[model samples]
Target: MQTNNSVLVTQQIKTWLEQVVIGLNLCPFAKRPYKQKQVKIAISTASDDDTLLQDLLQQFKLLENTPIETTETSVLVVTNHLQDFFDYNDFLNLADALIEQYNWQGVFQIASFHPHYQFAGTTEQDPENLTNKAPYPILHILRESSLDKAVESHPDVDGIPEQNIAKMNQLTKEQITELFGYLKD
Candidate 1:
């Protein structure tokens, strides 16, 4: 069901992941799955919260049913609804409730990303916001097993956010603006 636009958006996400994330060592764990072709990117077309929840459930099942080595993770990209960061942020509650609704506790987790991602206690212009900002709203779905392995190997997990903030703070405004422009359109 992926259209041309869906392909384009997923490609853009890949570009961002390569050029900014793995390229900059922002996520030390990302490179492995990406290189092994274990990453699944799906462009969601749901226009409402309920439909979006269903789409997420479907993706969750797809990843769960597939072999771990085949697809270790999935990124559900939403280019349709939840453009507003506040709404997108609030939607995580619903997303989390789905895991409980289906008795999927400890089986999956959803990480949020948005074009205008702003961390709590920070303003919109804060450089640290760049850490989670993406070309579009996305739900990064990861198997709890995979995450457990990743976390076990990464002893400095708690320091990641601080390191990302410091890294983004090192960039000048021009560089940040250029990267943001590349991500958008």
Candidate 2:
């Protein structure tokens, strides 16, 4: 069930997501092949499920140099799966290049789907809790979320696919607060 507050939050999220979609230039679905195919495919966060991403990549390769705008044929990825050994810059650089060259625009965002409100935590039984515990700029995300936890906490966003994990990006608290206007003490 949703409360009036939730309803308002949803509306806010919808509005922001819509603007994001336009800024990123994304569509719900790619146009049909015979219908001046506008979209290419959906990009989801890296996951155990590669079916969607793979299929989209295949279609994209088939029509190289098609002159589609960055927003026309891409979806931001959203997922919570990853390996321990991951390089952030390398990944972002590669992803950014592909988008620039292919004219694909959108954020490939990822979230751990963890319930914790903070970015850093450790196992309850760990002797030191340092091995698995690492500090992240999650507080910033929460600061962003604080503006409207309901919307920021979306289980699923319908805009472009989120490409990377919800790591601490450079977005300022003010920027996030602006993105979500419900922040209140």
lDDT of each: 0.89, 0.32
lDDT by residue (tens digit), candidate 1, 1-185: 77899889988999888877887778889899999999999888899999999899899999879999999999999989999999998999999998899888898998888999999999987889888888999999988998889989997999988998999999987888776775454
Residue 96, candidate 2: Cα error in Å is 7.8
The regions of model 1 sitting more than 4 angstroms off are 182-185
Across residues 67-102, which tens digit of lDDT does each residue of candidate 2 receive? 433223322222233222233322434444554565
The alpha-carbon RMSD values of the candidates against the true structure, listed in the order shown, are 1.5, 15.6
10 residues in a row with least lDDT, candidate 2: 134-143
Local error of candidate 2 at residue 120 (angstroms): 22
Best by lDDT: 1
